[model samples]
Target: MNKPVNRHPFPGTPKRVGRVGAGRGFSAANSNTRISLPGRTLDVSAFAAPASHARPGNLGLNSDRLRAQMIQRLRNQGIQDERVLDAMMAVPRHVFVDEGLASRAYEDAALPIGQGQTISQPWVVARMISAMCENRVPVKVLEVGAGCGYQAAVLAQFVKEVHAVERIRGLYELARGHLRELKLQGRVRLSFGDGMLGLPNTAPFDAIVVAAAGIKIPQALLDQLAVGGRLIAPEGGAAQRLILIERTGPAAWHREELESVRFVPLRAGTQS
Candidate 1:
């Protein structure tokens, strides 16, 4: 396996703030940013727009009712975290998919979002988020494979900031547009870069969630995790299992294997 790419710093003086509660607690920086990272900087401000709460037109199914059913099914499937359930309820999964497939958005299945990528199933997203937050609600989170940005949006509601990276340009732009329309671009920063090379400049993340399955956990991602941070990803092939890795100490981590799962391969580098 190849080494993950090195990440540069956010283009400004980023204060090292610890965990913070939800609500309007996270705010964007307005002043000029300082350039610290080596590669190109992703200007989150470019994707900024006020999120809209307007209801969509009838699309053969009632979104609210379907979303409710999805949440209930998640509950039945053992998703006990109330915050995770609420976030799933709050986000309109249909808005993250193509118009043709919007009707089946809440069917508890993964839908393709072009570029050979698929939005993660609701159950998996909830389970992963719940596990990562099992110890504590993270203040800063990193998401590998931004897909339609649905997971990032869901996570943004629970965490302070979300750094979502996507290796495919098409998927990255698609996610960026969806997130921008949902007005979640503020809290979810989208990047079109390699996923294996976890963003190092934004190191010591409170939580890291990988949407795709890898042969093994990337050491670079583990190195970037804070002491008390948690990282969850689908590991193994042919017989894949969800693995939860918690950074217990500076050089120590505790690993736990959860339920079985099937996910797209986690590829390295960018596809522009």
Candidate 2:
């Protein structure tokens, strides 16, 4: 992971929230230096290594301190799950965003990462992950819309395995590289495919999280949820609601709506 030495300081108050719906009214938007903790660095040729690797010991401490602050903010904002907070603290979010935007990575707001896509707000990510894991740690989790793999990486911290699907080729490759660089590739697997059609071959996931909003919950995803499993996603048109569906039995499911949210539309098929 590379530290931003000359980057602008993080804003005291976030100016905008993450990706908002078009018709909806809303505000629009780590690893040791040269040290590889989780996985190998991307082909160094594609992306240059940081100019400076000899960062002061305080740099890592600063990141830790910032994460702790984020955790506190999340707690005050209603993220009560300690497990989710811990995972947020562990994952170096900066690694998942472009180097230029690394400075704002810790902010609660969302930032663009090319392809007109944006990472979800930290609060949203924490809230969703917390809700999905409220009962217990899931053995296998499926994540739709991997967007740079930030959400999936967070889920990986608390789950046995995470299989994230992304429809865009650019994002899928970026996410794959990010996860690999973080050495979390083992816990998270990224695939370039249509997310609307959930991975059936690996059906019956303990939990499923969709980062994009759809007019209605995709039946393919619902069918893949294991008995007693939970699926959380933003659904509805014009107005979106964060919904949680728990498969209670072979043929029954209980659904509950959490908070109102805005996310990019979930699309079908893959793009190169």
Which portions of model 1 show Cα errors greater than 4 Å?
1-56
- Per-residue error for 201 in candidate 2, Å, reads 0.5
Query: What is the per-residue lDDT of model 2 for residues 103-218, given as tens digits with 9 covering 90 to 100?
Result: 67678766655544456667767767777877577899998777667788888887888998877666667777778877999888777788878789988899998766667777
Q: List the residue pairs that clash in candidate 2.
A: 38-183, 39-183
Q: Supply the TM-score for candidate 2.
A: 0.77
Question: Which whole-number lDDT from 0 to 100 does residue 99 have in model 1?
Answer: 64
Candidate 1 lDDT trough over 10 residues, lowest sum: 24-33
Question: How would you encode candidate 1's per-residue C-alpha lDDT over 20-126 as one tens digit per residue?
Answer: 21111111111111111234321110011112323345554588899999999987656778888888899988887666667888986656544344556676677
Give each prediction's root-mean-square deviation over alpha carbons: 14.7, 12.0
lDDT of each: 0.66, 0.65
TM-score of each: 0.77, 0.77
Instruction: Sum up the clashes in candidate 2.
Output: 2
